[model samples]
Target: SQQGEEDPQALSIQEGENATMNCSYKTSINNLQWYRQNSGRGLVHLILIRSNEREKHSGRLRVTLDTSKKSSSLLITASRAADTASYFCATDAGAGNQFYFGTGTSLTVIP
Candidate 1:
């Protein structure tokens, strides 16, 4: 079974709105990362939060990690129509330097 799974299968929002997504994992992890994928395109790394870090922000993206709870969240503020994309969470458990990914959350930002 995969280590991580994201909540909310899909989401729709208007431009200028905010979008939030969550991810849960089964075991201890060394780090967590979020990526954005536009339809029919490769993914782009958005943010990465290490186990020692509680939160991090890059531009409009905010990521929070709770190692104790084995959970993490990604928040995007002031989303734009171009922000419409599928988001995925990846977890690294320090096992062979491999990372497992969540199913993903599809976000649609309407103009």
Candidate 2:
């Protein structure tokens, strides 16, 4: 499968702390995207890094990609209780508009 799997199905951290999640896929991909979903809400796009790129950052979020290992990581620094959400890694397998999402890592940032 071209789908990726993320480690640590769930994580809990205090506010102002850092959270990290890792994902590993089975095939080459065009791009990988991270999304955040709050309870009962649609997903919000956090970041998207292409295969040729190694790392990218936005605000308190940092993402790293290693194509050779078909793996990726996302780091969220100084997280807040508002950051509590389910995070998913999605990969575009060079196909149409389809993407395969990881099982997801549920993060809880306690205040």
Candidate 3:
């Protein structure tokens, strides 16, 4: 297994519905972070759930971690056109605690 490998390489959802994506890793982590990146834009930090946390939420975003399974999921409530972007999971687990970014889930929220 990779350090961070996200599931559902692509997703399409209508506005107002929720979107969910999962990520799995192979190593223990200090924290796992989610990020959003608009096409041709820089990444925007979404949320960071620590190893001790089971879940965390921010605004319409919710994140859950299961260390035993080395997996995590991110859910965005009330999808919007503006939310169309690529979502990625990053873990602070590699050498020297560097971050490992996964292949993201590209989401298109149609209005």
* Tens-digit lDDT string for candidate 3 (38-89): 9999999999999999999999999999999999999999988999999999
Cα deviation of 100, candidate 1, in Å: 0.2
**Candidate 3 accuracy as TM-score:** 0.95
User: After best superposition, candidate 3 residue 105: deviation in angstroms?
Assistant: 0.1
> What does the lDDT come to for candidate 3?
0.94
Better of 1 and 3 by lDDT: 3
What are the candidates' C-alpha RMSDs?
1.0, 0.9, 1.3
Candidate 1 residue spans exceeding 4 A from truth: none
**Cα lDDT for residue 90, candidate 2:** 94
The collision pairs in model 1 are: none
Give the TM-score comparing model 1 with the true structure, all chains together: 0.95
lDDT by residue for model 2 (1-111), tens: 777898889999999999999999988999999998998999999999999999999999999999999999999999999999999999998674789999889999999
Clashes of 2: 0
> Scored by CA lDDT, what does every candidate get?
0.91, 0.94, 0.94
